[model samples]
Target: MEEEKRRLIMYEKLMAEIDLGIHAIDDSGKTVIYNQKISDIENMNPQEVLHKPVREVFKFNEGQGSTLHRAMTEGYDFRDEKQTYFNNKGVEITTVNNTFPVMHHGEVIGALEVTKDITRLKRLVQENMNNGTRRYRFQDIIGRSEPLEEVIEHAKRATRTNSSVLIVGETGTGKELFAQSIHNESSRSAGPFVSQNCAALPESLIEGILFGTAKGAFTGAENRPGLFEQAEGGTLLLDEMNSLSPDLQSKLLRVIQEKTVRRVGDTKERKIDIRLLATMNEDPVDAITNGRLRKDLYYRLSVVSLFVPPLRERMEDLAPLSEYFISKYNDLFQLEVEGISTEVRKLLASYHWPGNIRELEHVIEGAMNLITEEKYIEFTHLPLQFKRKRPRPPEHNEIFHEEESTPLLKDYLFQQEKTFMQRVLKEHNYRVQETAAAIGISRQSLQYRMKKLGIQKIRE
Candidate 1:
């Protein structure tokens, strides 16, 4: 009996430490029990709430009905963020709330409530609306394309709401670039942007990276702010959030809910104010299925989801992109090469670019360095193994000999002419000018054919 009493006492203490704003409404619609979070949100003490009518305590409307009462009578779960009418202050407060019916054995007895304050978010939203333009908008995104335009548009929407974001794509797809653009366009743009990669940093170092420790917290310790601290009043990006263990995901969930972080070897929790963005190379759902990514963490991140398209899908930017990279590398590598050979473009377009834009950039830089020329790049300047040959057209010498000017078949000759052009490109190693000159065509005309054939490499 003594042990049971002691265990009961410990269990009650455990319930008191819960961070969620737990509330209990009896069948009579009176507040029977409330947790610290609820007390703080309602600006009332537990004693004041013990038996007060919920309507009087919360000043809820009798006609519209309380979400809590609805949950109890209907035995349905209620959850959402809404503007709730206040009695004491006569003002509305936006609350992230969850209400569920409480039952003993199999019988419903009351309803439990959990509420969180989002008033600060409201102010930030209002200020942004009045300004008519955010400090960080989509214009900051450097790319111009249908996909990129859509991505920037979503980033703008994400800033208006304080929901977490998850960016999923392959490596070198500019995940971090997009992540930063989102942050810069968000309400927290003025604050520092802290970025960390779970795959880059080991688990042993992740905790310290997230929650800073004191000077003596560990052996070689110096008082340093973790990424979270640096990102306070700004944004923190975990580039590989799925790499975190299940344990870290739980800790992260607490931080998201409470907006606080406690340093290692510390006794008190420190508050943090920042937005969060995480990235992944794989589907978050798959990660969860395999136990690599936490489901709760996935839920938190997927509130605002954006997937960057692979470069192969954005072929419209190929030529301009090649030019862009050429110009960029021209300054970086100190080269005067105008651009890649026409054949080089065809060669690039023919190969399956699995590596995406990043791969294209590297190839351009590689070819530029190998050329060592000032005028124009040659087909041989590109990676040779990637070049593929086009089939040659059979000579129609019999027809040419049939008459001096046998009825000139235009489109048929054009088809044969186009095929001949492709063969010429292969011969010149896909160098545009070389292929054009060989086919008695100009570089511009060749470019038009390449574009017409939907041939592109190194998408812009």
Candidate 2:
């Protein structure tokens, strides 16, 4: 009995020292031990909670899920169960708990509950989901490609200065991730980091929300500080910059130049201190030509341009990114997914990925949801779109039935080169500049290839 008493004392000491909340109840549901951490979380004294009934102590809502009650009454163990309630002060609290029935000699004796507070983190995640972006640091970016590495290095350098940065990439290329990373790395990281989508709002509201509006400025107008003032001494991200009207673009240029803004109906200009990061979905040059973006504003905003390569260009990262997403979703959905099959990996790598990483993540997530009791994800578990038959050229055996009819490698290479040049020329309507840029080569190089391949522009 003395040895058992000593063990119980040691267990109590260990539980008290730990940071997370822990509380255990006796067989009759009366509290046996309530530690200091639980006291702190509940904003109540340990003395008040000691020797109380479990349901009374927690005030569990009758119909709502109750981890402690279920574990004790049903003799079941629950892991990572979420519970929410109001504390003594009427403050709402959210927690993830592991509640288990304490057994002795193959019979249920009591119940113990361990909890960790995740209220703040949960709120932030919800905000990000609603806004289409989140706070992320450099470590969150997953990539090993040379182009991606170069861009990361450039973004790190950009954090040292207050110059405007323009991140140019196609949609779903993680422009917002880079912007948030820069903000987190900058010297003013402790300050607020605000993001707004220029394309998500109308022009009139966009301007007011960005530059603030004084009372009497318009109907139902109230004096307010816009995103600029809210992000004082910090960073502001303008997403989809090309969507801003020319007049708004001009105003933004003036704000960047003068370092001041005048709220509507107010003549007083407020001096501001902020770092700006802007993102564009389409090519900036195309935006300029289409008059969707002002050229001078582009030059000013792109003082440090960081280009994020599309997924198709960094095919080597597909496997690692896939594994990362799998691990992430496994934690999220509580699955036992070991990894993707070799055939599935190859299929993912070969995909054109017009939607880039975002689309790949959706595919993996969709597949994971349908996978059950599988050690590894297989090609058969992939989405139906992936199951669709893809056309292929004749196989080697079909192309050369005769044993002596082996084709030379150089001849095959020449045919492939000719086909690629013709396809690119046709896609660009034979325009030298567009075709060269699309092919990621200089116009002179494209011209040389055209002459070598004897390819001509197609007429409509």
Candidate 3:
């Protein structure tokens, strides 16, 4: 009898030490074990709860569902089921419960419930739901060019509201950085800042990802929240928005207008409240003309549009941006590098950085990795591609070489036309609508000529 008492005391002590709330009920719905954790979680006295009817102790409304009651009567089990309701003291609580039916001799005799208080966690979820964290601020963006300054100023003003913002720029132009900065400056800064790149995702899965999936909607589909729902009361950045399919674009427009989303294969709409920031490497007009983007959606998203200038247009910022990258990499690599060679700077300035800021950062990082105990980045340390000299302009004599045979008029005219088209396309950063507008032609006509002349579109 002494040994049995010691064992009972040890069991009670073990139950008291557990963090999870444990509540048990016998076949008559009378409480059998109500651990200290359960008492604390429910804010009730153990003496007041002991041997009481389970439904009465929990204050379960008549005809309302209760997991422990279900387990006791139906002999079923539930795991990780989330329940939210007001307690006896009128305090709202959210909890995840795992209930199991106790069986003896092939008959259910009682039930045991394990619960975890998730009220604080659910509050956090409602406030911020980004998968990870955002680490960018306005000060992190380094630039001084006029166009860049204009973009930065516009972006700062966009943080004042929950309205949608559309950012247009070429690849490597720091679109995502701008998005993060805006989110950090907004009222929703404490909330989540989620981002998704439409171009990086497969076409078939984009819809399900942005919306959500209802249980039994498809193979392996469960009742899951989507980016929009997850970003409730926060910010959602949709990068490369132009790459989304037309069907998806239409649905996106509806969501933006109604502030509600219907999960895939689910008929009911779930309302959401979130700020939107979308980025596109191509011109929105081009996307519309090509039927790749919906016009209404573009208009809705462009409530406040900001455009980041390309590196070639913002050459003045190259030096500052390079210096910034150098300083960043120095800390990252634990290097004492101070500056770059004059020749290296000249080379960087002269060469058009087709990849913009991202490419510049890569070049600096690669050079930093190669340098050891060097005070400065030398010309030799530069990438081989950047080391190559730019092709010199053709001399007057070379253009009209006396020794070379004169070209045919048709060939000469065709070459001139192709060269002009290529220059215009490059000036517009290969954006179809902008190139067409600049070259005084329709998008369709330019596309046809590009196809006929074998001029390939440059990838952003």
TM-score of each: 0.53, 0.58, 0.59
Model 3 clash pairs?
A: none
**How should the candidates be ordered by lDDT, best one leading?**
3, 2, 1
lDDT (tens digit, per residue) of candidate 2 on 418-437:
88888878887889889989
Cα displacement (angstroms), candidate 1, residue 241, comes to 1.5
Off by over 4 Å in 3: 1-132, 389-460
Q: Whole-model Cα lDDT per candidate?
A: 0.69, 0.78, 0.79
Higher-scoring candidate on TM-score, 1 or 3 = 3
lDDT tens readout by residue for model 1, 81-173? 353657465655556677889988988898987776555334432432333123333554345777666666776677776688999776766
What are the per-model numbers of colliding residue pairs?
A: 8, 0, 0
Worst 10 residues of 3 by lDDT: 391-400
Error of 1 at 322 (Å): 1.6
The candidate maximizing TM-score is: 3
What's the candidate order when arranged by decreasing TM-score?
Answer: 3, 2, 1
